[model samples]
Target: MSKKIYSVICGTGKYIPTNIISNEVFLNNHFTDNSGKTFSQSNIEIIEKFEQITTINQRRFADDNLTTSDLGWLAAEDALNSSGIERESLDYIIFAQNFGELRHGNTGVDILPSLAARVKKKLNIVNPNTVAYDLLFGCPGWLQAMIQADYYIKSGEAHNVLVIGADILSRISDPHDRDSMIYADGAGATLLTSQTSNTPTGILTHKTRSDTLEYSEMLFMGDSYLPENGTKKGIYLKMHGRKLYQYALKHVPGAIQDCLNKSGVLLSDIKKVLIHQANGKMDDAILNRLYKLEGDLSVPFDVMPMTISWLGNSSVATIPTLLDLILKNELDGHKIKKGDKIIFASVGAGMNINAMIYQV
Candidate 1:
């Protein structure tokens, strides 16, 4: 048997902001319909219902002084330091984010310099060949970047890569929209390096699905719900919450199954399902449906680790952040040992859904 080169996660790190925003922050938001019509329910009632649905009490927000690139740099530095690999040896730096860097109080594209480029500059890598680029696949961006890194390794185009998932939804969310409560700011990163081994380890098999024709606008930017909040020209992250939820329920589980089938890995062998923390109720339903498909009604308590309850949904950052936490033993009762098979899956803005199975 010949050895094959695979992309293995060599290091992991994350940056969770110190500023905590709680549900109370939205208690006085005066949320309204798309036409600026005020809600009939009181803020208290709305928050209660939100908590019941999303199980999110609070989330982090980068300090007003920080930018999305700053968060990415922090996470990248942590991952780089942990890997103990020379910075000049990195072949690529992939920064996964959606709305560029729209800092607090300044709602601008700020995309002149890609976040990856900015992060690379911050890292001060003198190597001109360490190609830096940004990706915009919405919440699944980070996972997608990892998949790309795997390709680079398997194809022998690259050896070491820095994949960073960082986003600051706080700056892009419409303050008048209740959905804003589900958005958060955080960054997480992983270092993937090429390795040759006879055993099936690291990244094994992966699958991705995109349903844009019908669900293209399921999650997109639009004018604020409350017209009085700002100029009509200003836009923010908006979503057809119900439609998106339905789409995830209909497709995400199947996508997971596709990756499982591709890898020939049984559901019983996967010790962890590090799924995107979009919404608590939605995640619960997705996992339940997935387990049910395996003829098992009970989902093992540790099978799916989550951070949405306190971290909210930081778009691309969710999965990597959750993985970093568990691997570092920061998420209580969750730990992955050598040879543990885990699955990473996500569904987000592109109406994109993906799943990957990895052995650690």
Candidate 2:
């Protein structure tokens, strides 16, 4: 029998815009409420409360000249350069994002010329056979794309694939809404290549599930009316924070446990848990519960590295960017060594939750 094929992450890259929006800036600006009236003292109090809840001090936003595809392209280029892989040799490109390109001051997304296709053109790759497509699995999108690429490599259908997760959520956010502080813009990319290996490597196992029937409405983006504006339509993201927090607390731990069991990896062997940078508090709670499932009441503080305080929640871009930072030794107290086991988990829109086991 031929040697077993496995997919291995060859390189990683990330792109964060230069524009910074701090909490102080939000405080200085006047914002209109849903009723078209300026926010009162009580509404202004929400900013401080938001900082306490999310621990997000600031976030990056793309420049007016850039689009979501542009961010993804810059990240993809860096990933390719790090991997030393020829662009023409890539067999596939899987790009993930919830909102496509957004016009300044516009809440609608541009759907034509898919982001994946745009990245392909930006890279100037001449291979017509290289397949490219966009994935929409919410925040778990990048991990989902990596899982799909693993199958393609294992099936001998592809040698290498580039996976990207990017979003310009600021473009779609309502500046008047306090929740907009949690959304940012950024992109991350990873290159996975197939290789023959006798021992297990790369993605060992994964689990993805969605609770659309019960929790889909818990978080969404849709039209919101401004009182005096007379039926204005803006697709702004909305979330029932408390309900979603409860949902995550109930389900995320179980999902991590299932992934570990499926991969035959012990909790003690995992060097790090790269979770989605959604809410710092929620993420800590989930990790606390997850460690408890392993029969340990004491939680390892450094086992998970967080970027939400600086990067905010860029949806799908969270995990890959965190991974890139850790891999490059940019994140303090977090580093991955060869043969170390890592677990990735995320929860986001679609009420979707997923976990994956990977070996470095």
The candidate that achieves the highest TM-score relative to the unseen native structure: 1
lDDT scores of the candidates, listed in order: 0.91, 0.87
Q: Per-residue alpha-carbon lDDT of model 1 for 190-268, expressed as tens digits?
A: 9999999988889999999889899999998888876653564556889999999999999999999989999999998
For candidate 1, what's the RMSD? Answer: 1.1
Any idea what lDDT model 2 has? 0.87
- TM-score for each model: 0.98, 0.94
Error of 1 at 317 (Å): 0.5
Of candidate 2, the 10-residue stretch with the lowest lDDT total is: 223-232
Report the number of the highest-lDDT candidate: 1
Model 2: CA > 4 A from native: 29-44, 224-232
In terms of lDDT, the poorest run of 10 residues in model 1 is: 226-235
Summarize candidate 2's per-residue lDDT along 238-316 as a digit string, tens digits.
7777899999999999999999999999998898999999899999999989998999757766889999998899988
RMSD of 2: 2.1
The residue ranges of model 1 lying beyond 4 angstroms of the native Cα positions read: 229-234
Instruction: Give me candidate 1's TM-score against the actual structure.
Output: 0.98
